[model samples]
Target: MKKKIISLFIILTCLFSSFPFILAAQNLKLVSNYALEDPRNLFYLDNNVYVADGTNGLKIVNVGDPNNPQDQGSYSVSGVCFDVFVAGDYAYLANGITGLQILDVSNPLLIDEMGSVVDSNYAWGVYVVDDYAYMADSDDGLEIIDVSDRENPVEVAESSSGGYAEDVFVLDGYAYLAEKSQGMRIVNVTTPTSPTSLGVFNDGSDIYGVFVEGDYAYLAAHGSGLIVVDISDKNSPSKVTNIAFDGMAREIFVENKIAYVAARSEGLILVNCTDLDTDLTVMAKLDDNSETGSGDAGVYVADNYAYVVDQEKNSLQVIDLTASGGGNIWLWILIPAILAVVVLIVRKSTAKKEPSRKEKLSDEEVEEESNEDGEESAVVGIEESESEKEEIELKSIPEEAEDSQEKSEESEQSE
Candidate 1:
């Protein structure tokens, strides 16, 4: 009985331990592509794709059919558009030196400029939440704009303490800024007009983009690759780990423990960050040679496709991420193991109740049966011992197979 219980516990442990690896090895394939000019950044809403086409302004593409993306319309802006954020009926753009440009994108074909807040500092990124728009103005820190009035956008507050803010991501009531050469800065934006600094984390790397999910902030550090920071304590953010890449890391989009990175020379690189407590590992990479560009500017994942902007290719390439691979193998292994454990537990419980029925016998009858039924008792005990031995052997099969696989992988890497 003790041996059987130990075997069951081992099987359950192995079944639960494979979850992270099961989610890490996802298979991805190129679905389709749409040609455009100098596409810098992109955002997907409903079924439409709004791209920040450099010098060409905003380009809208209908992705209702990902296999054949159609160009719906485009609106030209004054400055070189870098980033875009769509909210309700308006599309807010970070228009370089032109500052923040609000457009009425309710009608895709005729996207008219609703308002503009021209500033001296160049705008690199924009994030809109509620009635306010946060702009990461280069060398000028963060700028808060009031978009309550679409036609007349106003700048209510500005913070220039964190030098050269390149990107901003807001969550809850705090705004996270990717400060160039300054790492990251957290600002409390509960009051839109008078934002206060909560904390700053400088790891001596140039941060180009920032994405906040849960209690962690994933930063794209130019030459430093990807840096994960623990923001659970807003007052004191600390670096967790830094994953280096072959090329410069410009932007990142994370979904389901997978990070889609826009690496300059490497194109779209997929990373497995399922275990963030340790170093991040590169699972797959779609290099520039796979496409046409040396510069992969932005990435956005939705449904099961990763939308990437290839600057030199002048197009948007959609990569399919729904293909089955190693995850299926883990699923197949786990299901049967779980069912087997459940069956063993039921059998063990049933066997324990079977002995209770014999308790009704008188003491003299029990003694007589013990002497007369000695052979039957011995047979039952032998059967149980055989069952436990079989279960223990079954528990060792997966452990041995796992060891063999690890050895094979190590040998291949060494060679």
Candidate 2:
């Protein structure tokens, strides 16, 4: 009985402990899906979504109705579209190998190339601020372009850190570069004509994407997972902490204190970064099986839904964030109910095995049975005593017979 009670306690504890994981699993709900061809990157603007479709050029999807996203149109480019950034009425494209391509996207169905600057280095990423576009030119470092003249974009400033710049993000007056093997390099772009390196934080990890919010820079460091660095002092950036994931951290999108991460094969990983002073924790996770494709390459969160780009399936997955009731509440109610049922079943089984009160002997009957047992024991004791007395008499008779024989022998000898 004691062992059974211990087992029940252990089972209940485990069930309760699993509630958090169950809640996390059900948090993300797939609302809808839109298919594209080899979608590599995504960016959300107003009610439109721009996708960098390899070979297919830029594909636009109007998501005004999130539940039913409609394909607006597409424009073909000469090179493979790698990344995109939309500002005002124009869309900037990082055309791999072909260099930077600009397009006027005022009309979703009629996007036209405004201008482009051809460079020897492959343009992997781009970030636009004011009249300038900071391009992550692979091996060539940062190339700043002036887009004020939309018809004729020109390279106003260019600087090289001697590292492979994979992605770039401009904030305040600085350009944050995710340099492949060099970790993060901060460049002072207040003076775009002569961009100079302010500082660098090297962890020797391959950084693929970077996003800065407040004083911390969240880096999607490929195999090393998500690395958080304090960049309040640009000249001396320090590591805050790192949150490791099972798959490669490809890209990250922050909204409402939540870090929406595109974890390649692992899918979308939601992390809570409300407080960076402490270790970052995974709030929830959505895998490929969750109505998304196997290869999660990019993520963009706007309004109440998260738009995920899957390179493997070449599709865009929209996940609902406003849906409710899929939390630990149900688990809380279920655990106790299950425990109660188990307890009742165990009690019922115990009750059936226990003897009924009516079946038990009355006090008088018990006394009568005890008296009979005592009488039987007394009788057995008397029989044992009688057997011993008989044996003693038989022994005495043998001794007397031996004594008579000895007396007769002595008389014969004397005669």
lDDT of each: 0.84, 0.85
TM per candidate: 0.73, 0.72
In candidate 1, what are the lDDT values of residues 1-415, reduced to their tens digit?
7787787677667666765444433445666789888788999898888999989999999888888899988998889999999998899999999999999999998778889999999999999999999999988899999999989999999887848998999999999998989889999999999998888889899898888889899898888888899999988999988788777788888877667889877788877676787778777777756332267889898876778888878889887564442343123224445678678775884476445646988899888888879989889999999999999999999999999999999999999
TM-score of 1: 0.73
Q: lDDT of candidate 1?
A: 0.84
- For model 2, where is the 10-residue window of minimal lDDT? 324-333
At residue 180, what lDDT does model 1 achieve? 82
Of the candidates shown, which would achieve the greatest lDDT relative to the real structure? 2
Off by over 4 Å in 2: 1-26, 289-294, 325-415
Query: Candidate 2's error at 17, in angstroms?
Result: 21
Compose the digit string of candidate 2's lDDT tens values, residues 354-380.
566545879888788889989999999
